[model samples]
Target: MSKQGHKTRANLPAGGFLAIGRDVTSTSDTSRSKPQVHKRELPQLSSGVLKKPRLDFSGKIPSSTPSTSSVKRAEVDDSRWRSFCAEIQIEPKQLLASLESAKEKQKPQKAARLICAAVREIIDHRKEIGSWVEEPIMCSALMLFVKMNTSFLLPHEELIEVLCSLLSTNFPTSSPGSAMAPLLLYKLLMRATDWNWRLVESFIDDSLHERQWTDRPSVDGLIVNIITAFGTRIPHESMYTACDLTYPERYRTVAEINRFTKVTDKEQKIDAFVMQMRDICERKGESAPRNLLRTMCTCAGNGNVRLLAARKMDSWLLNGKLQRYAMELLLWIASNIGQGELTEEDSETLSSLLKLRALKSKQINILFNIALKEILNNDKGMISAVAKLLLSNEFSANRFPYNMTMIHSLFSFDNRSASKVIAREIAQMLAAKEEYLRISRTFFREFVRSLLRMDFDFALFTSHLFNAATEDFSVLTIPTFFFKSLIDFCVMLPFLAITPTIREASQQRRSANGNLTQTHIDALQKFYADLRNFFEICTCFFRKHCELCTDNRLFVYSYYRVLYLAPAEYYTGIDQWPVETDVMQYMRVISDVPISEQLLCTVLEAGSDASVPIDAADTVDVIENLTKRASLSSTLTGSSMVPISTSTVLETIFRITEYKPPPTFNVQDENLPPLAVKTLYWKAWLISLIWTSLNTDTLVKEVYYNYPNLKLIMQIVLTW
Candidate 1:
C-alpha cells in the first residue's frame, strides 16, 4: 500500500485502523505522499490553511473502502479548521459591488452569475461546510443574507428551489448538539422585512408541494411550529397591512392565494393543520391567546381558514373548552389587548363577529348560528358561557337589542310558517311550560338592563322606544311590557332614575321624532288625549266624594291609595278600556278634599292625565321621611320630585293606591251634587271659574292665530 494510504489509516483511529509499516510512495506521484514525508513530524494545520485548505487525501482514499468516511471526519475536527469557520464573515457591500460591476459591463445576467459562483465555491470548499457546522459562522451568514437584500436577494423563479435545497432536514448543530440551523432559518424568516414576504410565500408554496414536507406523520405539527416562529417576529399591524396588500387586486388569482396559504391538500394534512391550530388556539393560555389570535387572524385571512378559526373560537366558548379562563381570554382579545393601533378592517371584522346571533343570515351569521346550536344542543355549561358573553361588560350594548330583535322575528316567522294546529300546540306548550317564560324573562330583563345602562342620548332612546312601540302590538307584547317596566324602573328607582345630568332628557326625547312617524305620533297623541278625558271624569267622581267625606286625612289617604294603584292596573288591563275607566272612577271619589279638588278641577284639565307626572318636591319630602304631602296643584306642576318616600304609612298608602277599588259604587250621579257642600266643592268652583273665565279653547285658538307654527312645534314636543 502507498505511504499516503498509511497516513490516511493513521487518521482513522476511531475506525480501528493500524498504520504500522507501509510501502514508500514517489514524490512525483502527487496523490501519494513519500515515506520520508510520513517519517517527519505531522504538525496540525494553521488557521489560515484550515480556512481554505486543499485536501491532499483524494487518491489515497480507496474506492469501495469502509475507511473512506473516516478521512472526512478528521479534517472536520481540526481546531484551526473550527476557528476558521467561526471567524468566517462576508462583507455584503463587496458582494453587491462585485455583482453590480459585472452587471454594468452589459452582462445583464452577471449579477446572478456571480451569486451562483459564490454559492458553488462555498459548497466545493469541503472545509467550509465543516467550518460552518463546527463554528458560529452559520448564524452570521444567515443574518447577513436576510438583513441585506431580504426578499430582494432571491430571484422570484429560484426562490422556492433555493429555500428547499438549503433548508434540508439534515441541518447543522452547535456544540451542545441542538440543531440550530432550522432555528436560524426561522429567525431570519421572521425578521424578514416587507421585501421578504414574496420569498416566504414562494418557499411555503414549495414546502406544501413536497411529499416529505407534508405527508409525514408530524409534518402538519412541524409546519405549525414554523408558523409560530414566523409569527412571533411579525408586527401585529403587518397582518392587516398584508391583508390590504393582497385583497381584491394584487393576487387576483386563486393560484396566488394558494401559494400564500400553502394549502397542500383539501383534506387530510391541510385540514388537519388548520384544525390543529384552531384547537391549540382554543386551549391556549392567556399569555398565548392574543398572540395566537393575532397570528390566526393574520394568516387565516383566506376564507376557509377564517371560517375554521371562527369555529374554534365558537367551540372554545360553547364547549367550555377553557371554561372561565377561555371567556376571560376572549374578552381580553375582544377588548384589544396588546394591539397598539386598530386598523379599520380589524375593527370591523372583530366587532361584527362578537355580535350574538340566534339564526343564520350571511356567511358570518352562519358561524353564529352554528355556535349557538352547538352550545344549546350539547351541554348545560354552555348556558353560563352564553350568559357571561352576552351580559359581559366587554361586549357592546347595541348588540343585544339588535340580536334579540332578530331572534323575535325568527320565532314569529317560524310560528307563522307552522300549520295552524302546530302553532296552536306550540302556544299551548309555551303556556303550559312555566320555565320557558322564566328563562326568557330573565334573559330579556338582563338584556333590557344592559340597554338601560347604555349611554343613551335622549334622541337615541326615544328613537329606540318609538320603533319598539310601533311594532305589531300583539307580537311585541313582551318587549313592550319590558320597555314599560324598564321605563318605570328608570323613573322610579332612586339610583337608576333622577338623572341630574340629563335634566332635559324627557324634554329632549319628546322633541325628537325617533321611530314615531307622524301618523304614529298623531295616533298616540289622540289615544292619550282620550285617556286624559277618561281620567278627568274619574277625577270628577272623586271630587264629588271628597265633598261628602268628613274625615279629611282618611279621605286623602284613600285618595292616594286609589291614585297610586289605578294606573298600573289600568295600564296592564289594556284589553278592558272603559271597564278600567269605571273602576278608576269609583276609586277617584275617595281622595281628600284639596287633592280631590285639584285633581278634578285643575291638574287633569292640563295634560297631566296624559302622561304620569312625578313631583320632584314630593320625592324629596318623601325621601326625608316627612309627613308633608305637597298640594295636588304643586304635583301637577312637577314640583320638587326626588324619590318616593320609604315612609311606612306613605309606602303603604301608595301600595294600596295601586290596587283596584272593589265594585258597587253608584255611577249614575248627575244633578244631585251641589257647591258649598265642603272645601272640595268650593275648590272645584274656584278651578271651574278660573278655566271658564280663560275659555281654554278660545285662548289656544287665539295663540295659534298669533303664532301659526307654534302649535305644530308644541304638538311635536309634547305629544309623548
Candidate 2:
C-alpha cells in the first residue's frame, strides 16, 4: 500500500491504542545497567485494561547500596521508554480512529494533530518550554487538549500558551463540538500546574474582554475528577487555569463573579474536596503536595471567581498559605457575603489554618475580623468557631483591628443578639482566665485610647438605629469592658448629650436645637439602657457576694461610695437609697465577707473601676491634648467634627460619667500644667450639686435644665 493510503486507512474509528517505539540500541544498554520496573503493580483502570507498558527496570544495578534511588531512577526511565513506545503505536491507531469515529465525534485532523504535536513538543522539552518566548497558537491549543488527560504524559509548563489562547477565544456555543471543546480545554488546563502563573493571568485579562459563560454546561464531573487526582497528587497546575476552569465571569474579572449562581451550594463541593485533601495530605508528603491546592486557591482569588473556587480555601489553609493568601481570602469573601452564610467547613478550615504556629499576629487579626464579621452576621455555626479561636493558645485580642465600617456593620447588621452573645463570651473568657484577661485588658485599654480620636457619625452610624424606642445595643452595648466603651463612645459625642438638653431649655434655646430625629432619642435611650444593664450586672454580682463580704465594712463602704458617684436610679419600691448603696449595706453584714479586704484595695486593684474621679481643669488639659491629636476639624456645626468632649470641664465630667480613669498628677513632670493638676484636686467640688439635682430631675431633665449635672459629677469626685 502507498504510504499515503496506509496513513488514510490507519485513521479509522476504533479508539485505537498506541504503542511507543523504543530505540533498540539505547534500550538494550539501559536495560542491562538499570533496575527493573514492576508494571503489574500499577492500578488497573476501566474494565481491567492496562493501557500502560511493562516497563522493564529489573535488569541490574551496580552494587552502590542497591538503594531505592537506583530503583526509582530505573523505574522512571523505563516508564518513559514505555510511554514513548505507546505513543508510537498510537500515532497510527489514533489517526485511524479519529477519521472513522462517528462523524459527529470526529474533529478535523489538522486541528487534532496540531494539538497533539504541541503536547508532544512540551513533553519532550519541559525545561526549555518554560523559556519559550514565541507565543505559539498551536502550542496554546495543545494546552487546552492535554490539561485533563490525567496520564501525566505532558509537561504542564507549556500549557500556558494554551490557557492564554482559550481565554482569548469568544464563547463558542454555536455547536456541541465547540462547546465540548472548551470543557475539554478547561479539563486540560486544570492539569497544567507547572505553567507560568502569569499566563493564567493573561487568560483572565482576556476573559474580561470576551463574552461570559451563559447557560454553560458545567463540567462538574470533569472538575470533580481533576480535583480528586490533584488532591492526591497535588499537581503544580497554574492558578489562573484552575480559576478559569472553576469560575468563568463573562465580564470584568473577579467582581463579575456575582453574575454566576449564588455561592451557597458550592460549599458542599469544597467541603468534599477538603475532606479528601485532608485524608490524602496527611498520608505522605509528595514532591509538591501543597502546590496544587495553593495554586488553585491563588487562581480563584486572582480571577475574582467566587463560589467553587472559594471551596478550595481550606486547601490553601492546610497548605499553610494562611498568612500569605488564606487569611486575605477568608476576610474578603466573608465581607462580600453577609458573613452569616459561612459554612461549617469554612470555619473548620479557617480554624485549622489559624492553629498553625506559623501564622503571625497580623494574620490573626485578619482572621479575627472574619470571625467577628461572621458573628456579627449571626452565622449559625460560627459561635463555636469564635469560642474555639478565642480560647486558642495563640489568641491575642490586642492584635485584632477594627475599622469604622466594621464597627458600623457590627451594630447595623442583622445579628445583633449574636454580637451581644459574643461580647458576653469574651467577658466570661476574661473573667475566668487571668492570662486572657491581662492580655485582653491591655487590648481594650489600647482600643479605648485610640477610640477618642475616632469618628462615629450619628447619621451613618448604626448605633443611631432603633427598634421600638430601643437602640441596637446588642452590638453597641455589653456587660464588661464593652459597656464602659459604649459609655465612652457616647460621652465623646458631646453634642448628642448637649443638644437634647439644650432643646428642652426655654423657647429661645429650644429654637437653636435642630429638629432631633427619633433616631437620636432612641440612641440616647439605648445608651442609657446599656449603662443600666451594666449597673444591674455589677449589682447582681455584688448582691451574691456582699452577704459574704459584710464583715469587711471598709470594702462595703468604699464600694458604696464609688457607686454613689455613678449615675443610678433610686429604686421606687425601696427607701430612697441608691441601688449601689442598697447593695453595699446588705453586703456589709455578711460575716464571711473577707473583712481584711478593704474596698480601696479592690478599687485600686480592679484598675477597671469605672468611677475614677476627674475634674474641670483636668478635662481642659485633655481637651487641649485631644485638639492637638484630633485628625478631624474642631467645627461642631458641620460634618467635620468627630465628637470629643467640649471643654476641659466637660471632658473631665464625661470621663467621670463614662468610666474613664481620672488622669493623675505627674508630680515629677515639672513641665506638666499646674491647672491640669489642680483639676484633679477639685474632683469633689461638684458632688453636692449632682446629688441634689438627681432627686428632682430625670437624666434627661437634669442635663436639660443646664444644671451641669455632668460637670457636677466630675467636680464632686475631684473634691471628694
Candidate 3:
C-alpha cells in the first residue's frame, strides 16, 4: 500500500472514538462520505459485538476492530480533542479541516519537528502559560485548564508579573484581555504553594501609579480584586509594606479615600494590615505612621480592630486631625466592647489620651464612661487613673459636668477602696485651686449630693477636704452652694448610724445583752468625730473669711443650723468647746454688721403667726404690727431707731415666709434656695430646742420666769 493510503487508513476512527485526523489527499465529498459511514457504524459497534463481515474477493476484509492499547489511546485523544473543540467553540470536522490546511502549509518533516518542539516547550513550562497568554479568553481558558489539572500550579512570580502588566493596560480601552487578568491571576496565585510578596508589592506599587487602573470605575474594581488576592496570600508584615507603598498620600482622610476608591469592603485587608503595623510600631516603642493611623480610622466600625487601633492613640494626641479620629475610634471601641474587657492599661491609656485639649465634650464623656465602668468593676488602678483624669487640666469647664458626674459614679460604687481613691482626687480637685468653685459650682453641688446619698464613708472625704481647707481657707470658699451642700452632707453624717438601714444592720450585730456592738459604737464615735471636725473647720473658715458669711447669709444660716442640730454629747466630751468658742468669735465679728430690716420683720412676722400656712402666709398684720412696734420703741427709748417702710418689711416677710418643705429636715423640697431651706430646718430645730428646754426646766427658761422684764420679753417672743 502507498504511504498516503496507509496514513489515511490509520487516521480512521477506531472503536467508537471520533476521528481526529483525515486523509489530506481525499476530496471534500469523499471525506464527507467516509465520516457518515463511520457515524452509522459507531453506535452499533459500541453497543454490541461486531458482526462478521461477508467474504469478499478483495482478500479478507481488513479487520476494523481496534486493539486494547489503541482503543484506550484513541479514547483519551478523543476526549482531549472534544474538550479543546468545546473550549475553542469549533466543530470536530472544522478542526480537522483546519489541521489539514495547516499541514498542507508546512512540509511533514518540518511540521513534525515543530509540533514536537512545541509539545516539549509546553510540558517544560506549563506553569508559565498563564503569563504568555495575551487574549482575555485564552488567559481565562488556560487558567481554567490549569485549575482542572490539579497537579499543575503557576508560579506566583509569573502571576504577579502578568497581573501588573494587565493592570498597566487600560482595559475596555486598550486591551479587553486586561479585564480578565485579575481573575486569571487570582486563580493562578491561589494554586501556588508560595508567593513572592516583594514582587506582589512591587506590582501593586506600579499599578497604583497608573491612574487608569485606580481611577476608572471598571478598572479599579479589577485592581482591587488583585489587591484582595494579594492580601489573602501576603503575610501581614508584607501586606503592611504594600499598603505603605500603594496608599495614596493625596487622600488625607479615610472618608476621602473611601469616596475616591469606592471600594469599602475590599479595604478590610488594608485595615487589618495597618492595624498590625500599628501594633508592631507600638511594640517597638515607636509611633505608628500617621497614614497607618488614618487607615485605621476607616475601619472604626470594626470593634476588635478599633480597639487594637485605640492602643496607639497616645502618639496621635498631638495631631489635630488624627487626634480627633483617634478619639472617635476609642469612643466606638468603648461603646462596642464588653465593659469587663477594658484593662487597666487600656484605662490608663484612655486617661492619658484624655489630656488632649482638643477633645470634644462628647468624646470626653465616652472616655470617662469607659473609665467609670472599669472603676465600678473595682479596678483600683483604673480608679486612680480615672480620678487623676477627672482632675486633669483636660477637664475644662466645658467638661466639668461630665467630670463631676464621673466622680459621682465612682463614689457610688460600694467598693470602699475605690471611693477612697476618688475621694482623695476629688479633694485635690476641690482644693487644688479656687477657680473650680466659680466655674463648676452646680456640678460640684450635685456631685456632693450624690456622694452623700450613697453609703460612702463621709469621714474620709471630709477629712481630706478639711485638712486642705485648714492649710488654705480659700478651699472652703468653694461656691456657697457647694459649701452648703458639704455642710448638709456633714449634718447627715451623725444621723447615718440611726437610719433604718443602719439600725437594722447594727441590730443584727447587737450583743446578747442588747447593748450595741463595739463595731457600732466605734462607727458612731467616728461619725461624731468627723462631724465635730467638720464643724470646727467651718467655724475657722467663717472666722477668717467673715466676708464670705456676710455675702452669703444662706451659708451662715447653714453653719448655725449644723451647730444647733449636733447632739450636745459631741461637745461635752470635747475640750473647752473649741468649736463653740470659734462660733461665738465668728458671731462677734459679724455683730456690728447691721441686720437687714426685712430680716427683722420676717422674724417678728414668723413669731406673730401661730397658724402659719405651710404653703403660704398672710404678712399684712405682721408687717403693720412690726412698723407700729418700731415707732413705739423709738418713742419710748428716745433713740433713733428708724421706722422701716411697709414695702421693705413686706418684701422681707415674703422672702422669709415663702414656705416650702426643707431638704434639711427630711423634706423633699426641690424649688427652695439653699438658705430658705436651711431657715425652715433651723425653725423646726428651734421649736424642738425650746420644747426640750422648757420640759427640762433649763437655765434660760428659769431666767425668763424670774425677771418681770424678761418674763414680758419671753411672753412677747412666745406669743403667736
Candidate 4:
C-alpha cells in the first residue's frame, strides 16, 4: 500500500482500541541521559483483551516527602489509572490489555507513551473537537493520570513549553480550550513537589522575556489559575505557615498581569482591579469569600498588586474626580468584606480606613450622608444592613474619631429631615422590643446627643412624640452607661461639655451669665430652652417606663436610678415645673412605681432635711457615696416584677432626713467628681418646689402625706 493510504487506514477508529503512536524517552531525571522521544509507527486497531498492571508496594512512597511528577512504582494505582484512561475516551479495558501485553514484553513504558500521545492529541485538536476538551471527564482523566503515574510525565521543561505553546501559539486566548489546557499541566506541576518550577522562576527572573508568550493575558490567567488550584489542595490554605507553598514566589508573574499593573496612572490600575473584583462578585454570590479584599489586605502585607491605592487614600486630591473612584472602591470592598454584612472586626477595620483617609470634616459628612441615604432610600433589608454597619459600635460612640462630625452631618443634612426620621425610627424600634436597645444602644445614645444639639423646636417635637407615645419604649433597655452619660452631660456638667468642638466654641461664654454677644446669648438661651423640653421628655419617658416595673425588676431598679440621676430637683420659670407641688408631683409619680443597698443611699442623699425651693437656696452639705455606680452593672439584677412602692421611698426619705456628715471639708480627699453632693445641691434647690401643685386631677393633696415629715429638711437644703 502507498504511504499516505497506509496512514489513512491506520487513522481509522478501532473496534475496541485505536492504535496510537507511542513515544517515551525521558520519564525520570535518570532517563534524561537518553532524552530523545521517538514516535512509534501506527498500523490499525486491535480488540485487545483486559489485564491489570502488577501492584508494587515495595516501591513505597515516603509520606514525609511529597511526590514529584517523576512517579514511583508504588505511587501507581492500577485501578485508578485504568479508570482515568477510560474517562479520556481511551476504552479502559482495551488500554489495560495493551498495557498488560507491553508488561509481558518488559515494555510497560509503551502504554505510558500511548496515554501521553492521546492527551496531547486531545489538547492539540481541542478546537477541531469543539467542547470535548472542556469536558470535566477530560480534565479528571488528565489530572488522575498525571497524579497517579507521574514517573511517566512528559519532561518538566518540555511540558511547560508545550502547554504554553499550544494555548498561545495554536489557539486564540478567548477560546475555552486555550483557557482550560493548562489545568491539567497545572495539576501535574503542582503535584510534583520536587519540580523547580523553572517556568515560574524563569518568568519571575525574566528569562523568557526575550521569547515571551504573545497571548500574555492567557498565560497570566493560567498562572493565576495554577496558583489558586494549588491553594485548593493545600492542607490549610488560609494559613500559609501550615503549608510549605511559597505563595509570593509562586505568585510572581510575567507580562500580562505585570503589564497592566505597571501602568502609570495608579488610580486607573486600582479602579480596574476593583471593577474586576466587582464583576467577580456579581458573577459569584455576595457571600462568596471576598478574595480580592483578602488579597488587598493580606497579600498587600508585602505590598502587592497596586496596594498603594488604600495606603495613599489621603494623598489623593479630591479634585472631584479621583476621589469618586477611590470612594467606589472602598465602598465596594466594605460592602463585600462580609457580603453587605461586615462583622465587628471588619467594621473596625473599615472604620480605621475611613478615619485614616478622612482628611477633612466635609469628607466625614459626605460618607455620613451616604450611609444615611442608604438607610433612607433602600428597603428594610438594606436599611437593617446599612444600619448595622454605619452604626456599628466602632462608629456610634463618643470615642470614634469624627463621630460628632458624623452627628453634625445629620444635624445639617437637607434641613435635618433624614436625621429626624432616623431618631424617630430608632426610638420606636427600641421601645417596641427590648433587644433593639441592647444591639442599638450606642446609636440611640448618640442620637440622643444629637437631639440635645438640636434646637428647642426639635426637642419640643421629640417631647410631643413621647407624650403621644404609641410604642413600647422601655428605659430598662437603655444601658446604664447611657443614662449615666446623660446625667453627666445635662445635670453634673454643662451640656456642651460632652463634645470638644462645642466646648471649644463655648469657651468664651462658658457660663450662661458670662459676657456674651447677642448671638451667643441667643444660642445659649435656645440650647437651654431645648433642655427644658429635653429633660421634661426624659422625665416623662422615665415616668412611663417607671410604670413598667410591673413589667420586670430591671425596670424597677432602672426607674429609681433614673430618678436620682441628678437627684430630684424643682424648676422655676422653665414652663414645665412652676411650683414646688409640680416638682413633688413629678417625684411622686416616679417614686409611686410599684418595685436595694442602692435605694437607701439615693433616698437619703437626695431628699432635703429642712428647706424648700427658692431662686438660690443655701447649698446643702453634699451627701456622699449616694453616687450611682458607673453602670447598674452589679446591683440592678431586674430579677423581679414587684415595683418599689412609694411607701418604701417614703420610709427611706423620712429615715435619712436627720442624717448628717462629719463637719469638715475633706473635699480634696477623692479624685472622682462629687456627683452625690452636686445632686443634693440641685435636689435642695428643687425640694420646696416639690409641694403639691394642686392643679392636676389624678394626683390629690392627700399624696403629700406620703412624705409630709420630709418637708422639714426641705426648708434648709434647697438645690442651687
Q: Which model scores highest in lDDT?
A: 3
Clashes of each: 12, 48, 1, 37
By lDDT, is 2 or 4 better?
4
Tens-digit lDDT track of model 3 for 374-427: 334434455666666776643455454345555656666544655556445554
Q: What lDDT does candidate 1 reach at residue 151?
A: 39
RMSD of each: 20.7, 22.1, 25.9, 22.9
- Candidate 4 TM-score versus the reference: 0.31
Worst 10 residues of 1 by lDDT: 68-77
Best by TM-score: 1
Off by over 4 Å in 2: 1-221, 228-247, 250-294, 298-524, 531-720
Q: Each candidate's TM vs. the true structure?
A: 0.33, 0.31, 0.29, 0.31
lDDT of 1 at 613: 32
Candidate 4, residue 613: lDDT: 19
Over the stretch 309-340, how does candidate 4's per-residue lDDT look in tens digits? 34344433243434443443343233233323
Error (Å) of candidate 2 at residue 483 is: 18
Write down the lDDT of every candidate, Cα atoms only. Answer: 0.33, 0.34, 0.40, 0.37
